[model samples]
Target: MMKKTNYSYIGIAFIILVFGILFVPKIVDRISNNDITRKESRSDQKLKNKALKQSDLVFIENTNNGENRRVPAFSFVNQYGKQVTNKDYEGKVYVIEFFFTTCPTICPRMNNNLVQIQNTFEDFEDFGVASFTINPEYDTQEVLKNYASTYDITNPNWHLLTGDKAAIYKLANEGFYIYAAENSAIEGGFEHSGNFALIDKNGFIRSRKDAFGNPIIYYRGITSEEEGTDDNGEVEQISILKEDIKKLLNE
Candidate 1:
């Protein structure tokens, strides 16, 4: 009777050992995966906070935070010949770029990249692109429409706006902090910064450093060499612009 009791105890211990060997690895795997997810979440939060801290951007006081920049007022006409103004963009996030309809180099590259941006964020109703024509006389509403058609741009949210030369130039220089000048020597007879800005719904420009390391809320345009690279390896300034927009949207 004592020997039979001892054998029973040994049998029970062997069963428990086999069970642990089969299920322990699965439980451990689940725990490891959970830890990785938590780490990724923390990393994302850190990046968002870092971007918000850059002094290059202006901010507005709000219920959540007391810092943001306010965009100045403006009146312009879109490609469809409809008037566009500040009220139209009251609750929208958009990027503004200066480009001419006809250009030999940079403008074409810039505009093409913008098309990609438009497609990438097409599903976002609150976001859009604003391509302002520096050559107002040549890039009239009709000309802009023609240009839009060639690019197969059917999205009305992407506005190609035109207004008084002085007013437009004022916005470009003082408001957008970009360089735009009438240079006959340039291929397009006009020259402007290759950069574009990501504006929040409240119109605060996103922050990035300028060439001089000044606090600027604009991304420099694709130029002669070495800069932002996208996932597919096509070099363009739009990649940086795209990432910045995503970060703002997530916030």
Candidate 2:
């Protein structure tokens, strides 16, 4: 009986030795080669890669000078009645829009899209929005403040700016090439493009190239992501704009 028990113990020890010698090193090697990751971890890694897998964004250039167009210098009072200038956005990636609080047509849709963007980047301190009211005469700091509240605009960097009418129009029409003018024929008594300009950290305007390889220059802002396409068949660019903003932020 004693001899038989000893044989059984020795056989078990031999099998354990074989396992350590034959399999342990391969397990260690798999770990070292990153081939032993969990399924969840692999999925997460794929998502990270996809998020970062975007083509380079292009700088919108001046037709006459062949130089990168930049956000021109301007100063205006924010919703909080604080002075804001281009200097305030020096190292930030921001969106610029011309809007008014009392606008009855496209402005609401444009701002709703912007507010969605604001929520998406709420955690990113360097992301912001500059809403220049085309009707600054009516959109005083108080009215702008009320509008901000109504829209639930919580990002401290987002400024609903209002100031000199002439300067604002110049910034819209000449500086950014987004039209903003008084038009009694328009429903809102003012007319402006429902487009948003994207600016990089260094203040240069940036955009993704179109299918034909030209800079799209402006992103459509009047359509919400949920709406997808409008009555005129204009597809919403907000989703792409958000992705491009992420690219600029990473840059």
Candidate 3:
């Protein structure tokens, strides 16, 4: 009777071991699959957040051009006698401004404001500053070089560009969407917006602070009201611009 009872106990133990062998791996696999799904869900959420940050930036859109908007192709000569086109700034972040060296009204302040930004990011190689001359006739490369000296601009990263009026105007008005016209009444003999434009590395004009304020919500770019003043309104512009640049860089 003792030997029979011992055999019965061994039989029960063997059955329990066989059941664990059959079921344990499947249970572990199910747990591993759930963990993989959880990890994938977390990755997707991070990507979604990153995309939101990129799209939150202001975009200059032309419904006529469909949903995708970009800066038109352009070619010009920089102050250093180098041919500057969209290629020069490809894969890099940059700021573009429309101004002539002869302006006695707003260009001074614009230059000064730009100087501060330049100084701030002077060491950043992936960044650049390009100022286009509305009066290309007077702002030849040599002349631009001379004017740039006034603001102590010594870095080649800060390019002053000049080119044919028709191309420049098309780019300014249609590409960058800033107003550039021959106006005899304006102090500089030309009428152009003082708004500085921010361009992403992908050749898209990300933001324009101009008269239209096209979207009317973005405060990072120049505004019609802010451009008219001589005070520190641009201080706010500088702050926003810096923040936006850092935002883009991080992404």
TM-score, per-candidate, Cα-based: 0.66, 0.78, 0.72
Q: How accurate is candidate 2 locally (lDDT)?
A: 0.93
lDDT of 3 by residue, 93-190 (tens): 87888889998877787778777777778787878888888999999999998998888986667899999988999988877667789899867798
lDDT of 2 by residue, 141-203 (tens): 999999999999999999999999999999999999999899999788998899999999999
Best by TM-score: 2
Better of 1 and 3 by TM-score: 3
The lDDT values for all models are 0.76, 0.93, 0.76
The TM-score of candidate 3 is 0.72
Which pairs of residues collide in candidate 2?
Answer: none
Instruction: Tell me the spans in candidate 1 whose CA falls farther than 4 Å from its real position.
Output: 1-68, 208-216, 223-236
Candidate 2 residue runs with Cα over 4 Å from true position: 1-55
Clash total of candidate 1: 7
Backbone N/Cα/C clashes per model: 7, 0, 1
In model 1, residue pairs whose N, Cα or C atoms come closer than 3 Å (at least 3 residues apart or on different chains), thus clashing, are 58-69, 59-67, 59-68, 59-69, 60-67, 60-68, 194-221
